[model samples]
Target: MDKHFLIVSFLFCFIVAVTPLKCVTCHLRTRTDRCRRGFGSCIAQTFESCMSLKIFQDNILQLSYMVCQKFCRDLTFDFHNRTYVHKCCRYNYCNIEI
Candidate 1:
């Protein structure tokens, strides 16, 4: 019985680990911190992760976006007088808090 329990536990862990991660999806979030478009949820594929992007103008937050992105990387770049920060994470809804 103990051996059977151990096998069951291992199987459960494996299943959970192999399952895809879920993430919050928001195309555009205004400065008011509210989602303005494409508000929903997404399931990340095996090679994807939850990503969050924040756009700042003059050091003030102007917009935010979240989604499940493939080959996502954490980075910061400046363009057109705005700074964009990209962060990636693994796990369910992790981007929501980024």
Candidate 2:
């Protein structure tokens, strides 16, 4: 029984240590000269990353979001008058910054 208990406890701790943490989430949209938004805590699944993005339109900050995302890589894109900035991380609330 003692051996069994030790094995189970170690396994539990290993699993918890290896798993990624939950993140905070939010969204914002800019209109003319102003932006409006809200934020909250969010849970992320295994194999997911916390993501944050800032969008610029015509060189002006226009929109932004924070989310628990499954994947992101080489993260930047631009088209026409819009630009997007992306950051991805695995720790809790890591998406809080742009």
Candidate 3:
């Protein structure tokens, strides 16, 4: 029983250790922005989407690359879904429909 408990504990710890620190939805939005949008609107749109999801709205500055990885995993964005905006310089943004 003790050995079984140890194995279970280790597995649980591994999962917790690998789990993303940032919220999943926010991560998805962030990754989508990175693959599609340049930077400016990516930050703004991701921030707003994170706010709407009630996840990491106030902690954008503290976000790490790992959390961003979580976003990339959850998002299905790619080169095709990207759109260009011509406000001044050519800018791009992801068009995640769902």
Off by over 4 Å in 2: 1-20, 29-38
C-alpha lDDT of candidate 3 relative to the true structure: 0.30
Best by TM-score: 1
Instruction: For residues 1-98, write the lDDT of model 1, one tens digit per residue.
Output: 99999999999999999888999999999999999999999999878999999999999999999999999999999999999999999989999999
* Local distance difference test, each candidate: 0.96, 0.75, 0.30
When 2 and 3 are scored with lDDT, the better candidate is: 2
TM-score of each: 0.89, 0.66, 0.25
Per-residue CA lDDT of model 3 for 21-65, tens digit only, reads 332222323533342222222332232221211123233322212
Give lDDT: candidate 3, residue 84.
22
Candidate 3 to truth, TM: 0.25
TM-score: model 1 vs. ground truth = 0.89
**For residues 1-98, what per-residue lDDT tens digits would candidate 2 score against the true structure?**
99999999999999998775888777664545233565676777866778888788887777778778786653889977689888888777877655
Model 2, CA-based lDDT: 0.75
- Distance from true position, residue 89, model 2, in Å? 0.9
Lowest lDDT block of 10, candidate 1: 40-49
Clashes of 2: 0
